[model samples]
Structure formats: structure tokens, C-alpha cells
Target: MAFFKSRDEKKSEEIYKIIMDTLKNRGNQVYDLKVEFQEGVVTLSGVCDSEATRKKAILCAELAEGVKKVNSDPLLLSEAAAQEQAAAVPPAAPVSPNPPIQTAPPAAPSVQTAPAAPVSESPLETGFPSAEAEAAELKPSPEPQPSPQAPETAARSAQPSEPVQPQAEMQTYTIKSGDTLSKIAKQFYGQANKYMVIFEANRDVIKDPDRIYPGQTIRIPPLP
Candidate 1:
């Protein structure tokens, strides 16, 4: 049983570290994310700049070695915002003869919301028709049927709006029998030398690395 348990634990460690490292490199996040893996499943619960990063993080985890499955309900995303940010980026070449513009999907609620904010500063009233005509145009057409493409577009534009702070609340780990600092470091991070990471995270509880013993519980500090 002990041998089986050790192998399972090692598999978890490999999966977690490989995924975190992948995200750090691709996402340009400065620090390796703090991850906790058990069994063959991985949970990602953390803050990221935008929804693109969040989705990319999950995808990276899914591709990691030995990861059986991934749970991303805890993932936080801002898809609309990320898409807008990408759109806002400047193009390298100068605007030439009027080229075809990519119209946002009708399901993109963001275009309406975006134009609303800018409308206060600049007049957009002249382009569209009067209130009654505009309302009619905005209304869903007769045939009263759902568009086949609506669901697919809406699925792509969706983002996580729920708050996700409790992932860190009251969470801590204890040193068990036969565990060493290097081993704990390797489990939490990809490298064994990152034992300093564990030490630093639990500085208040740990007077010295050498003094830690079995059953000594400590707070799992937030990654720097």
C-alpha cells in the first residue's frame, strides 16, 4: 500500500509542476503559481490579468504529463475584456484603401456596451436611425427561431464573473513522517532547490528548516 501511495503521489507532483511551469513560460507570469495536486486531478484557483490567460492556463494543465483530468470551475476569466484588449492593440501597417472590417458577432454584447461608454464623449446619434426604427432593427426577426450560430458565439464570449478568493482561506499543510524539505519543495514547485520557497512561505512558523518535525502544521503562504 505504501509503495502504491508513493507512486500516486509522485505522479500528482509531476503533473502539477509541469502544468504550472508551462503557464509561467507562455503567460509571462513572473512567478511559478502555487498549486496543490492530489490523486490524478488538478485544481487551478488563482488570479490572472485577463480571461485569455485563464483559458490558456487551463489548456496548459490539460496538456501536462500524467494529468488524468482537470477541474476549472475555480478558474476566473474575463473573455470579453481580453478580446477587446486584443482588438485595441495597434496594427503595424498604415490604414490603406478601405478594407473589409471584421464585424463582431451579433451575440457579442460587448459591442453595444463598448459603444455606450464612448457615446458620451463622441456623438454616434447621426449614424443609426431614430428610436422606433432602431428598436425594430435591434429586435429579433419574425420566424422567432433561435439562430444556429448564437450558441457557439455565446459559448466563446463567456467569462467567469464569480468571486474566487476562498481558495486560499484557511488552507495549510503539515509535515508528515519521513518528509524532507527538498521533497516538499519538489512537490509544490518543479525544482527540489525551491525548498527555500516553502521556508519563505512559512517563515513565521518555521524558526529553522532543520527544526521541523512530524505533525507540525503551517500555513501555505501565497506565492510571491
Candidate 2:
């Protein structure tokens, strides 16, 4: 059983290599391509230049020996390809020009009557003093009361605060050929599945985990 398992593994590796070479040589334009083969099934994943290119990659995998099935569902189109497809769609027919708007003629200027002159009332007629005389009768406002003084308490000396420790500088790694986040995580943290540590740390640089390129610098955060 062990010998047969070894043979199967070897065959899978060979098929994987063949599919990768075919994609590159045929110019299928599949970026970040990953091929997995198991139990006579080959799965292709990556960003393709177009639907046609994605189909071509699947075909290449199907043509490889020992590949009973090709799964390309995980493949996706590049942003440029998606935009090209959107552009290809015919735009909605231009809306018919709107009819000229009809506006009412400007109204004639309204005539405003002049306000009637205010009638003056003498003190003898209304038996009330004039506003000026009333204002002079008002007494001066009382002076503001002095604010109460707060009781004093004994003063305490200010204690010196501890100096803040500097944060640990995050480590950085330059991507190399065949360097995947999972591999880098394993190298630094001893766990392949902790790739998210690197991904979350370098969100400014990495948009996709599988889309890293050679010579790109990424931050490696310290393990929590």
C-alpha cells in the first residue's frame, strides 16, 4: 500500500508540472496559477486574462495524462478582463431628448403700499410717561454678589509617570520566487495556517493572499 501511494504521489506531481508548463508556454495568461491533482482529478485556480484563457487552462489540464477530471471553478477573471466584459455590453439606448420646458411669464412687479406714519401719543392724552422718561426711572441693577470661596485642601505632589516602552519593530520580508504566505508563515511562526497573520499585517501591500510577487516587501507581525 505504501509503495502504491508513493507512485500515485509521483504521478500527481508530474501531472501538476505538465499543466503549469503548458499554461506558461501556451500563454494562457493565468496569473498566480495553482494546480492540485489527486485521485485522477486536476484542479486549476488563478486569475485568467479572460474566460477563453480560463477555458484554455482547463483544457490543458484535461489533456494531461492521468487527469480524469478538470475543475476550474476556482479560477477567476482579472480586473481588466471584467472591465472589458462590462465595456462590451451594449449601452441602453439614449433616452429621447426631453421636450422643451414651458415656463410661466414673469409676473408684473407688485405695488407695496407705504406703511402709515406711526401716530404719536402725548402724556396728557394716554396718561402714560414717554419711553424716555420711563427708562430714566429704572433703578440701577444690584451689584453681583461675590462668589463663595471654595475650602482649601492640602496639596499633594505630582508623581512622575513611568516612561512608555517603545513598540517592537515589525519584521519585514522581501518576497522571492515561489514564496507563498503559507510558506512564509511556517518559516517565521512554525504554522502554515497562520498566513493570515502576514496578510492582515500587510493589507496596504497585499490585496490578495495568492497574488504576491517577487521582490515585494511585506511586514511580518510578531506572534500574539
Candidate 3:
């Protein structure tokens, strides 16, 4: 019997193969796993042994080219973990057959308190002054004023700062045949790895660091 598949199904199969290959290469086992793709959405479902394997499978699918979104079904723990979890749960306590007897509430006793006797105030001594009079007698001295030197410091700070000199004007280099970014960087900055500086400066002109053509002028930024 001949079986026909649509273009979308073929694409989905290809994507699934790539994702499975990538996961296998990572040393993660995907048993009974199924991957499906539709309109850039990728879904992964099936049984796996460990949570790590399940998550790694999903991540691998997500990283696959053209994968817009990744959806995964809830992963079930392996049989060993399920058994361990089952063993961890305590069994329910046995229920009593006979109903508990109800008890009557106890009555609260009345409490009696004796009346308090009136208090008499003692007259203040004539020799000692009242609290207000004592507070008025003791006045705090004023705090020392800020030093006049602050004004001189302020004046110095107010003075215009020295103008900063601009970094050496950006230099340019016309790319020649057989010239690489590393070669150009070594020629200008004495460090081949510093080619990134030139690439960053001339992103508008140079799109790829590995590829530069002749007659393309690129900016060479000043060294740190």
C-alpha cells in the first residue's frame, strides 16, 4: 500500500528527526517520545525515565531551527520514583466505630471586687520650683555655625571644568584583497583578537567579521 503525506507533514517529520538527533547526541534517552510541528509550533509528548531527560528533550526541540514555540505534556515519574512516593505517604488512620459522647458545658462563677479608697494629694514644697520653671531655667546653647570655608569650596566647584579632548578621530582603512579583520586589527591595534573593535565600529559596512571584500572602507576605532 502506498501512503501519501503533505508538504507540512514532511517538514514536521524533518524537524522531529533533527530534534531527536540533537537530543540523542546530548546522551538523553527519549523512549516512546513523539514530536509534532505545525505552523512553527513544536510539541513534545511521551514517557521518559527522569525529569532531566524530559526537560532536556523539550529544550532541544526549542533550539531547533524554525521552532517558534515549544509545548510539552506533563511528564510522569518513572516506576521507581512512583513506588518511592507511594511508600512515603502515610496510611490513613483507622476510623472509630462508636460515636464520641457529648459533654455538657460548665457554668462560669461570678467574681466580686471591693471598691477602691479615695487617694489624697500631698502639697508641693514651697522651696522647690515647678517642672515648667525648671525647664525655663535650663536653656540649650545655639549650635556652632558652618565654617566660612564652605563658600570657598563652593566657588572652586562652580568654576568651569577643563574641556575634555575628543578621542583620536576614527581612522579608516580600505579593505584590500586577501585582507582579514584579524590582519587589519594586528596592523592597527597590534592585537588580532581586537578585530571585534573594528567590526563593531563598522557594522554598517562590514556585516560579517569572517568576510570582508576589497574596496570596502571600514572604520578602525582607537585602542583602549
Candidate 4:
């Protein structure tokens, strides 16, 4: 018995044909090109001649009717193609293995030090009084005085100290495609129900919590 193709299968086949025809018309050479279609998503796998060709193939697949998304991660350039691209770029200049050595000039000759003369014998040993001893005998040392302590003010010590309150910290996040207030709240506060916190903080920019567009900057307030 012969089997018939289902409605979904036929639709997938049509999408695949459309993508293949588009790629062919664009003159993109993709070796071993394979197209997998499911639930409006197309996945491409194969070797391309170059990165530009691969991108073109993916763009063609995406532009096809009934194609919601295209996965081109499996599409890559062949080894030969990669080598050709590498050859097109010039190689960097080679660095020298050994640099030139800089020699310093000879240092000036060291000067010779003259020998010190012999010291004479002390006056105390020769039974004559020294000048320092005679001076000390003429004048006596004065007594040392103590430093005074600073007085503390009674009015300054009786004042009470006030407590310091911390300021609230906020962060700004640019809205990306498919981002919602609840999703942002879940990312920052780890709870989807805390989306109101963000909505209240971004009242100037975000008038409605459910309505947000890409590229709009919103403030994210810290949770209490």
C-alpha cells in the first residue's frame, strides 16, 4: 500500500522547495545542503563556499513564506574555503630573535683614601682635667617641667547622636525584544509577582506595566 503525505508534511516540503529555489536563484553554492522544517522553524546544515554565502543562504531561508525562525548554527565554511580566506589576509611581520646588546662605558677609576693620623693620649690619663669636665663643673642642669592636660567641654559631651539611614539604590535596564516587566522582575528580584516594583519605579518612562517596547530604558528599583 502507498502512503500519503500529511498536510503538515506537504507544507514543510513546499517551504523547503521555496528555500532551495531562493538559494539557487541567488547563486549561493552550498555543498551538502540540508533543510529541516518543523513548526514554522527551518534549520540549515551543510558546508558553504564562504561566510557571505552562508549568511545569504540563511537570509533566503528566513525570507521564505511560513518560516518563523532559521537556525544556521550548523552551516559552516569548508576547510578549503577557510584556507583560501586565510591566505587572502597578509601575515604579520616576523619579530627579531635577538636584539642588539647595549654596552656601558667604563666607570671612572676609584680615588685612593689617605690614611688617618694617630689620636693623642687622653688628658685624664695624663692627670690634666678635660675642657668638657671643667665646663660641666661651672654650670648645673635645670629641672624638667611636665605638660598640662586639655580640658573637655560639658556641653559637647552631653549631645545625642543621630542614626544614619541608607539611600535606596536603583538600576537601569534597556528593554530588549520579547522582554516583559514580569520577566525583568524575575531576572532581578527572582520573583515574577514583584513586577509592580519595577513598574512603580519607571513611572516616567513606562506608563503601563504590560506595554513595553524594545530600546526603551526603564528603571529597576531594589526590593525592600
Per TM-score, the best of the predicted structures is: 4
Q: In candidate 4, what are the lDDT values of residues 60-175, reduced to their tens digit?
A: 78877788998888988999888988998899999878977889989989999998988988755657778998998889788787664444555556657543332268888999
Error of 3 at 197 (Å): 99
Clashes of 1: 1
Off by over 4 Å in 4: 87-224
- Superposed model 3: Cα runs more than 4 Å off: 1-4, 81-224
- Candidate 1's C-alpha runs over 4 A off are 1-9, 30-32, 78-224
lDDT of 3 by residue, 1-224 (tens): 99999766776787668757876787766667777778888877776666667777777777777889888864455786557667888999998799878888787776777878878888767988889988888978689997766877899988987543323668888999999999988887666888898899988988889999999988878866
TM-score of model 1 vs. true structure: 0.28
For model 2, residues 1-224, the per-residue Cα lDDT tens digits are 35455655676677667766776787767788877778888777889998778877787788878879888889889999989978998999999999999999999999999999999886566778889888888857779997854444222233454543322568889999999999998887767888998999999999999999999999988777
Candidate 1 lDDT tens digits, 1-224: 35454665666566656656766687634123444456667777765566667677777777866667878766654555556777889867976888799997777354443344443465555775798997988998778776576776787778555432322333477899988777766655545676776787688888898678889887654445
TM-score against truth, every candidate? 0.28, 0.34, 0.33, 0.36
The best-first sequence of candidates by TM-score reads: 4, 2, 3, 1
Comparison by TM-score, 2 against 4, better one: 4
Clashing pairs in 4: none
True-structure Cα RMSD, model 2: 57.5
lDDT of 3: 0.77
